[model samples]
Target: MLWGRIYFGVQAAAGAAWWIAVAVSPFVREVTLGGLDPVAVAAADIPLFVVGSALAASGVRPAVWVATGWTLVVAIALAVYATVTTEAGWGALVMATAAVASVLALCLVLTGRVPTAWLIAGPFSFRPALPRRIAAAHLVSTGAQIVVFWGFFLVVVPLVITSLENRWSVTLPFPSFVPVVGAVVLVLASGLGLWSGVTMSVVGNGTPLPAAMANRLVIAGPYRFIRNPMAVAGFLQGAAVGLLLSSWLVVAYGVLGAVLWNHAIRPHEEADLEKRFGDDFRRYRDTVRCWVPAISR
Candidate 1:
């Protein structure tokens, strides 16, 4: 996960910068929100950002809850600031965008739809399991999805992107009601993403992470049709992020991500599986396209 790492890293940087901008800089304090004090606002934001950053960096669930809650706070504060002053600031809208992403991410995580740890893009802990520990295992899996996938993509990415572009004060074009469509698409993508994870956990007696690789080769349900349904889900959700925010920059970010994953990550992952599963993986690879699904498999 190049995506996961950059996403969380950006969030951490943005949160810290925002706090500094509001608290340490007197010019920012006096100038923002038509001269209204941003001191209290910055004070409340940094803790959630810090905690969310730490948990998300480690791929844990509390990160999702904390990030979502903090973004909501940022949105409300921006709304209040807008009402008190006539000057339109980009910061509030940025926070609103973050709020949308956070909420969307939370919805997917709470569904228990996927064993999310399986989706983490980078290196992470993947413990082996015993039968009796299955109950606890499921809980841990759900938490990983919330923290890693949900928190990183939705909250962290947006925060980092906004900060890097220095676009908090710049006005951009956004269509009305786009977020509604984005949400629906995100939900659908998440459902597709989770299907395989659920199968791996149920049939393979394991999650999708390499260290906790599934005990069985899953050849049922969606796996029968496409080799990488999870990638499909991730692609959709990634585009939805740009759609929801109406940011071409972020949209480009998501698209480039897909290209890199296709050319770089997928090949390495498949080779590993081929070495692990041998002929079984080879037959499946030949029968099913990496991305395209069979018509009626």
Candidate 2:
């Protein structure tokens, strides 16, 4: 029952992310055009919308990857064109927003790849009784993510961009195809983060924590590279958001988020796992660096 709820929650969140991206992309383009017709701009996105919808419905890994890759490629190309040809006013802002929105949309497609078995298996299959403190922590962490990413990164940073444009003078140098390159990187990073988070959440809830909580670690997919790929990916996404908006404050906030996540949240979660998993947990911890990628044992 708990697993079902978690699965649905993840699905709902993923869907919302994609739809929000779709809605926002046009708005950003409109801002760039300065009240020009949005129909032409939006028409270009029809293929992306159709592909994304198909991936969601089919849930095939190859289709998801192909759709996501195409979206990223096209978005990046558009961003490059905008950067090179358009002036550095509302047009730049619009292009940057579009890039970020495309990245977020890619994330949604990646999230759909989370395995179905994880959703079907009840939480109790892993933990007969979830500790109250751990459950509370997970809830709080998820809530914090929503608030920080949506409220601060998305809303506040855009407002800051507007304020800076209106009040402060700023200049950014872009290489010939840098905008497109940056767009591609942003999409890939965001997609990886989304995939990692969805997978980790399933592992966190599905795996039986070691009595010491150290040994029952997941070592597949992105986890093969890093102990906390999800968190690292999230940090990257946040940094990209800061860069896209050209806001140092947002960047600082992203840094602060990483610190808080590592120091406060990760520790508690680790302790819970250790208590649950025991010596096996220690073995896994010893083999894996918390965030850095290492050669798998």
Each prediction's whole-model lDDT (CA): 0.65, 0.51
Candidate 1 runs further than 4 Å off: 1-139, 166-174
Global Cα RMSD, each model: 13.1, 17.2
| Worst window of 10 by summed lDDT in candidate 1 | 112-121
For residues 1-297, write the lDDT of model 2, one tens digit per residue.
233223323433543464456467865444444343446655654445444435433554464444445556655554444445442245444334444444444444455322323322443122422433354444444445545565665567656654555432234443555445545656777677655544444445332221212123566667766667667766766665656655554555567678867864566566656777788777778878887788644
Q: How big is the RMSD of model 2?
A: 17.2
Model 2: worst 10 consecutive residues (lDDT sum): 206-215
Instruction: Give the clashing residue pairs of candidate 1, or none.
Output: 1-121, 1-122
Candidate 2 residue runs with Cα over 4 Å from true position? 1-182, 201-216, 295-297
**Tens-digit lDDT track of model 1 for 172-238:** 5778887788788888887887776777667666666655666567787678888887677777778
On TM-score, the leading prediction is 1
